[model samples]
Target: MKDTGRFFTVGLVAAWYSSNIGVLLLNKYLLSSYGFKYPVFLTMCHMTACSLLSYIAIAWMKMVPMQTIRSRVQFFKISALSLIFCASVVSGNISLKYLPVSFNQAIGATTPFFTAVFAYLMTFKREAWLTYISLIPVVTGVIIASGGEPSFQLFGFIMCVGATAARALKSVLQGILLSSEGEKLNSMNLLLYMAPVAVIFLLPAALVMEENVVGITIALARDDIKIVWYLIFNSALSYFVNLTNFLVTKHTSALTLQVLGNAKGAVAVVVSILIFRNPVSVTGMLGYSLTVIGVVLYSEAKKRSK
Candidate 1:
């Protein structure tokens, strides 16, 4: 039984890493290399895929008991979260078009700093002094990495930072809005609800912001059916990313998830640099290392405080 459990945990971790990294690389490929410059539309597709898959997993497969919004207030709360989710995902995708994955991952490593800031502002939650101090390296590391980055774009950097901040905001807001026992939903159920709402929010935005995107995508599909397959695979991987994330958290602990996430970002940076053949400077590597070390310190501080 112990061996089986160990294997299961390892498998979950592997899936989580693969799905997370795969979705990111695919997003980079589609948005940048493939010239599919329709981030809103692409994000909508991801939400649609997530919505359908989550419904199937929960309702049909009975992955977990079905959950429903009990009141209008709860529905609206979920809608707000979905809006933030849309912004985070779309901006991240847009950034990929202009930035290398290695630099983007380096920037993304600062999520904990933004999370801490949002948590304090929104909920007035306070952490230990050590916890607060640990963020210094996280912020400083990103600054160093940004300075050393060889292929930096101002717009892309701004979008990436915005995406990271929005992601942190969503995490903080989710805790605040869903604190009630009656309103709380499991991760899968939350995704099932939030994904559809995200699609609804993104549809009009995609249509208006990305002129003739649908036509262009269709043209691309007609020219080469492989693009369609790539999109379908990419969207499927997006759903898997969320699913595996939840599974890993459920089977392990949140701290373990955080640790794995930090390592995954590093692995992604190395893999992306190799795959994309992006130029890297020693200073940039030092900065990313500093940021990662800061994140590790932050995690340790949080664990000790708890």
Candidate 2:
């Protein structure tokens, strides 16, 4: 039993990287080749699948209702958070359409900064000294990481920028809403609800904002195994990561867990380059290094503040 649990946890961590990094690269391709609209649609499809699969597993195993979310106010808040994330996904996906995976991931290093700012503004009166200062290096590193190449695609840049914002806001909101107890309040249960809510919200937005829906449907009908694998892996990976993240944080220190999560993203960037053979220049390496340092600094600063 002990060995089984240990193996399960190990599998969870490995799966986290596999699924998450998979989603990141897959979204990049879908965005670049198909369009942003396709990625958003794919997100919806993936989420719907995740929700169903999770619910089925819960039923099959007969785990005590893990933790179902309730409370109109809390659900509303979560749903709103989901909507913001939905928009963020759309923006990030579209950005990929117009950019290289390397550049896209490099630019995405800003998410930690955004998260810090959001956290400070919403709850804390201020960030710790190092946390605040870490922003400069992190931002600078992102600049250097891309070898100082800017995401010049006007619309894609805007979309990704929005995505960054959504990512920040959603994290904070999840922290807040997840505080309330529901009938079932585990990670799987929460995502089970959130995914559908997000998909429902995105359906209208996709219909209004993107004409790529028809194109995506046609592509799917043509039996693009690449697209299918990407979607499946992305969705599955996302669900596992979210669940593991929730469980790990509860078991370990939030800061430690978060730091690991941050480091994982950085590693994922390298893995993407290695696997996809995306361009990685000297400047980009420096930027990536600086970003790691900034994150470390930020973590230290935050620990002191606590």
Candidate 3:
């Protein structure tokens, strides 16, 4: 039975990862065409679509604990946290315009380090002395992996790092909320609150930041009709990300999830390299490898502690 569950989990993650990669590739193409507009619009669609899907599944399947929020406060809390979650995506996507996927994913691997820091500070009110210690290897690895590109943008780097921080905060905060309250909340109920919160926050952001820019960008990329389909599929892909993460987590240990997710950075790099044929350097590959290795180590430490 244990072997069966493990095999199922592996298959589940493989399918989930393959689908997500396909979606993100299409998403990248769409956003590249429509610029930031596609990213914002896709995010909205992703959350709402996934949430609605979860709701329907729950109803059709007659699942227990239908996941309805008990109070306005609970709803607000989930939404508020989800808003931060949404921002992480926006920041990461926008940063992608400036940096290569290799650099972007390398920077993102720091989430484990950041999550540990935030969890320590926010949850325990105690800081880990080793958090910075653990970060050194990751930083070193990314630098080695980035191939010392002279064209790197400092501002973009800052935004990407900021996105990492936001993701880390979202993880710890969501964990805290779920620990106390979300356990009782069904999958559908969680979506009910999460989607609205994310979509609402993204609205003003899209209008203020991406609205005027997207039209002009799309016009330039108009040579590609496929971009439209890619954008829609990308939106669906975003939702699947949420769906798989939930399903995968329930079936496997958090450590197992972390282990598989570590591949996202490297796999993204390989795909981006082959797809774009970007000039990736040996040093850059080395650094990327190191960063991922450090992240894996941090995850192992976390798992052992848990």
Candidate 4:
């Protein structure tokens, strides 16, 4: 049993990267080439899928052991996190529609900086000065990358930055909301609660912002079943991304998870460039490389401070 659990944990890490990259590319394909043109509706599908699959994992599979919010306050707190989650994903998808995945991933590398700033503001937590200084290269690299990006779009860049900030805020809020030992919910449990709430939050916006989702879905269904399959796969992978995030942190330390996140960002950028055949200037690549290196150093700084 111990060996099986270890193997599962390692596999979950792989699943995390696979799903993360897969969903990014799939969403790009769908929104760009496949002509989905409805980021909000697509996000709704993802949340619905996550909510259902997570429910099954808890109720039937008993994958992570069931957990429930004990009070209305806790429920509302989780719901607030759910709102942030929805905004992050919606903005990310919208950004992907306009920006190359490589650039998108490059911008995402600044998440740690945003996380640090939010943590200090929201939680009154302080880190070593070196930790803050390390972010200099992180911000500079992103600026260089943006300047050098051949396919940069102003709107896409703004949305991507928004997504990153929302993600950072979610991380800090999660820490505060779930800080108490008795109230802490495991990843799976949190997803189960959050995904459904996010769906509810997104539905009204999707309806208001998107055009004829039913008609578009039917058109795609008739024209190409492949698109529908991709949507399903994308949603399933989205849930796995959440699941593996929890599993990884359960089996390893937060620092290890952060390290993996850094690697994953680098891998996704390289893979996207290669797959999409996006033209990246030497300066841009160097900038992105510096950003990644800065992230690694920042992680190290945090570790040493701890």
Alpha-carbon TM-score of each model against the true structure: 0.99, 0.83, 0.84, 0.95
Displacement of residue 235 (Cα, Å) in model 3 is 0.8
Candidate 2, residue 187: lDDT: 63
Model 4: per-residue lDDT, tens digit, 1-306? 999988887898898999889889899988886788899989999999999999998899988789868999999999999999999999999998999999999899999999999999987899999999999999999999999999999999999999999999998999999889878988788989999899899988987888678687888799888878888888998998888788788888888898899999988988887788989999889899999989999999989998
- Residue 75's lDDT within candidate 3 is 72
Better of 1 and 4 by TM-score: 1
Candidate 1: clashing pairs of residues = none
lDDT values, one for every candidate: 0.94, 0.70, 0.70, 0.91
Q: What is the C-alpha local distance difference test score of candidate 3?
A: 0.70
- What would the TM-score be for candidate 3 when compared with the true structure? 0.84
**lDDT value, residue 62 of candidate 3:** 58
Give per-residue CA lDDT, model 2, range 71-179, as digits (tens): 6877787688778877777777778777666666656767878887788888885766767887889788876654554434557666766787788888787786666
RMSD of 3: 3.3
Give the range of the ten consecutive residues with the poorest summed lDDT in model 2. 145-154
Residue 291 in candidate 2 has what lDDT? 78
Give Cα distance to truth, residue 209, candidate 4, Å: 0.3
Predicted candidate 1 versus true structure: per-residue lDDT over 97-154, tens digit per residue:
9999999998899999999999999889999999999999999988998999999899
